[model samples]
Target: MDRIKFGTDGWRAVIAKDYTIDAVAKVAYATALWLTRKFKNPAAVIGYDCRFGGEMFMEAVAKILASKGIRVYIPEQFVTTPMVSLAVKKLKANCGIMISACNGPVNFNGYKLKGDHGGPMFEKDVKDIENLISEENEIDLELLNWNYMLEQGLIQYINLETIYMKEVRDNLSPEKFKASGLRIAFDAMFGSGQNLIKKLFPDEVSMHCVVNPSFHGVPPDPVRKNLNELSEWITHTRDIALGIALDGDADCVTLFDEKGNLIDANMILLLLIHYLAGYRQEEGKVVAGFSSTGKVRKICDHYAVPLIQSKIGFKEISRIMTEETVLVAGEESGGIALGDHLPERDGFWAGLMVALAIVDTGKSLKQLLKEVYSITGPFAFERVDLELNRIIRTRVIENCRNEVYQNFGSFKVIRTESLDGCKFYFSENQWLLIRPSGTEPLIRLYAEAETSDITLAIIEAARKTLVGEA
Candidate 1:
């Protein structure tokens, strides 16, 4: 049996190679065992996105959990990761499982486990479940007929989307947003979040909602490059206030300002913090990923709120939010959570909050960014993904470890941080972060500076250094 390993988020494998029914059975069986040991009558909520084979994988997972005498609650149709997490909390289930790989490529699928707190499972618990996976625990995947389980009261169909929509309506004021007179567009990227924004803001929102498992041959990530079409439309349109995009399973989001300028996650995180603290007069600790910009600390200091820099991953930020009084928590990947909302990352919820900020403040997204810049100062950030072979990747890591060069291009390294990646600081406000991807054979190079030109230069210089070009 192939060992299924969990990444920073979940266990993702390419379809047909390793992500087969047998492998899923092992993980599902392991999860079932863990649930049985934790609760006397374990109950779980299961869901899937609009990915290929989502139904099949979800059914397999449901059957395995039901066979173990664990009752399962599943959505009647496709749903997002947040929906499953919300279901766990609302339904009082012991755990939650989502079968869509959040933002992965078209040929990939995954399994995400959520705790009863409406967030990711604890890292320690996930490790324990991984340790429990073995051939002995694997059971007959079809031990109980799915329909028979349904008839026997083991499998219960749920309207998770309906339940989740109610929560959204309760938390966000779509009526206020509609009355604000600012038009907005949402591009679902053909992921599971399709048609949801329209349902939320029928009169105020323009939508590009569709269901395509292949993602129209593009990865369903809400990054700048993957969102050119949406950006172009927002740029050419006259009255559009901004554009929003959701990833494959709708756990993450990226935005474009009124002028169609890409507002990456760093800017969004800062905006969220400023809105909550400065506009809403909220008070609590702020949490951000290490990969996030230093502006987070600047804004937090300005607001007199505490701040903690977590390792890269929503799971880390989510865990801290549950334990602390977090006003806002976010990572560089666009998965943001607010203190007033559920602990889990909800792109839909985040978008609504952004809209509310624009409405209440009566400011454009660009103007709100300017407000944040008054504290953190003007800065630009960029990332480059270097696809290198194993040998080159190892050599690059060794070189970074040894401090091979005194500087990257002309930028001098004033300091270096090895929290989760090798962050070479050119100055207090300028730095380059080099980190190996946890799931792929690639190294990511991140740079930030006071200007976009400098940011681009730093990335180019770093790339040249890595490839021995200069």
Candidate 2:
């Protein structure tokens, strides 16, 4: 049997190799066992995205859970991660599972486990699940069948769209948004968020919804490079005050300003933090990932809100959120989990909150961003993905552990943090971070500075250091 390892979120492997039906069945059986042992009335909500063979994999999972006598609620069709989370919260299920990777390439599929509160499983919970997988017992999957499970009333089909729509309606005030006359463009990137915005706004907002499994041969990431068409549409129409793009499973978001310019996640984090703390008057702790910009700290300090930094991953944020009344938890990768909601990141909810911010303030996204920058100062951020051999990547990280940097260009090293990776903080609000990619065999270098030139220089210096060129 192949060793199944779960990453920051969950276990993900290329289909037909590690992600075969047998492997999926084993994981599903183990998850069912774990849930049965934990919850008094074990019930699970299962969902999948529009990935290839998603439905097939979801069916396999459903069969395994049903065979164990655990009630399973499988969505009737492909849906986003948020939909499954909403169902789990509403149905009061013990856990939820999503069978699609978020923003990965076409060939990759994954499984994400959610807690009963509709948040990603805590780190310790994930570790427990991994331990369960490690001590797995052989189980027969051939006897599992959908018909038998349905006849036994062990499996039920649910309309995730209906449940999700009701939640959106209950949370969002369309009348308020319409009164603001804010035109927004939603690009689902051919992922599970395809019809979600349209369903929520209908006649109020204009959207470009598509459900192409190929994702036009590009990964379903909401980065600027993958969203060229969205930029073009926004540029030509000039109708949308903001353009929003959601990842494959609709768990993360990327925004484009009215001028068709990509807004980096750092700015988005700062904007949301400012709005939630200053405008909403919410007083609580704020948590952010290590790779996030220092602008967040500045804003939080100005408001006297406690700021806690975690390693890169929403799971870490989720863990902290459970312990404190976290006002907002976010990562630099466009995943924002707001307070008063499920700890899991939801692009749909984040985008809607941005809309609400605009409506309530009577300003465009650009205007709101300008105000944020005025208070936080200018910050430019960029990342470089360097593909390397696995051994070389390991060596590079080990080398960075002891490596010290006195200065880079004209910036001086202020402090250093080795949280999840090596992050070098420099004077003049400049910093660089280097970490190995969990999902791929690559080293990612992230940097933020006062100017674009300085950011690029910092990234280049870090790349050279990793490659032994510096």
Candidate 3:
């Protein structure tokens, strides 16, 4: 058997491979042990998204926790990641477990942990749980009866979706949404981000909102490459104003403008900051992942709010959100958290907030972006995920570690930074970042420049710089 390990968020593996029932038992037992050791009567909130074997995995976790005498909170239907996070806080459970691969490809599944404060579990806690994975023991899960567990108060069903739905509706007004004269479109990408948006905006356009565990074989990541269909869905249509895509677990978000131009996370962050600070007069720190566009600093500076850069992953910024007063925090690949609400990323809320911003400013998405750029300046951003074999991936890391090349094809390296990954600066407004994925066997190359052409050129240059000699 392979030794189980966690990644940037949690344990994710291909279903029926490393993500089998026994593997889930091991992780769940470890979680049970950790909870029993940490709290006197540790209660847990558990849910799963629209993924393959979600119910099976949720049952495995519930039985394991029940056998260990821990209270388990679960839902009858599939729910989003944020729903479980919010339930953890509302139920005051010790921790939460969400069973979804969170935007990974259809063959994947994951176990995401949340703290009692409704955010990612602390790093130390995660490491402790990881260390306990090897200390697991065999258990007879079939011996546990669902009715008996329910009667014994070991497994209790909670309507986590209703919990999240009310919070989102309270913050948004359907009347105001209609008054804004802007049409909105949402693509759930066939993951758990369904139902609520339709309830909120009844007349808006929506697609892929059904429950398809396979996600139609499209990894539910909301990045631009995966969102071409959404772009085209809004374009050539009559007066559709905006397009929003949410991932499988509904924790990540991506948007498109009126013309179907992709509004990547970098632009989303800037627009959010502009709205939260300038329009709403909110105040506090803003945290962006290390791979985010540097223009975040400029916009935060314009708002006179401090910006903190965390390493890649939503958890790093979430930790700060739990302890500090963060107004906004985001990552390069569309995960965004509004600190005023919760420390976790709520893709549904993020989408509504974007709409709220549009309604508040009475402007189109492009006009709002133009206003943001007027302050932070314009920049195009792109991230390329390259699947590399062991040999080539190791070589790329070595090259980055040893400073193998000083320049790409034509872009000269002026400065370098390695907060979470190696970033090579070509000019004040242009840079390339090469970071290995903690959750997958891939390397992500990010580039930012004055235009989309330059951004693509930077990525191509970085690609050749790393693989030219391999």
Worst 10 residues of 1 by lDDT: 201-210
Task: lDDT for model 3, please.
Answer: 0.87
What residue pairs are clashing in model 3?
Answer: none
Clashing pairs counted in every model: 0, 0, 0
RMSD of 2: 2.1
Candidate 1 wrongly placed segments (more than 4 Å): 135-137, 204-207, 398-405
> Per-residue CA lDDT of candidate 1, range 427-452, in tens?
99899999887665689998889999
Give per-residue CA lDDT, model 2, range 441-465, as digits (tens): 6788899988898899888777666
TM-score of each: 0.96, 0.95, 0.97
Task: Give the best candidate by lDDT.
Answer: 3
Would you give me the overall lDDT of model 1? Answer: 0.86
Deviation from native of the Cα of residue 329 in model 1, angstroms: 0.8
Q: Where is the poorest 10-residue window by lDDT in model 2?
A: 200-209
Q: For model 1, which pairs clash?
A: none
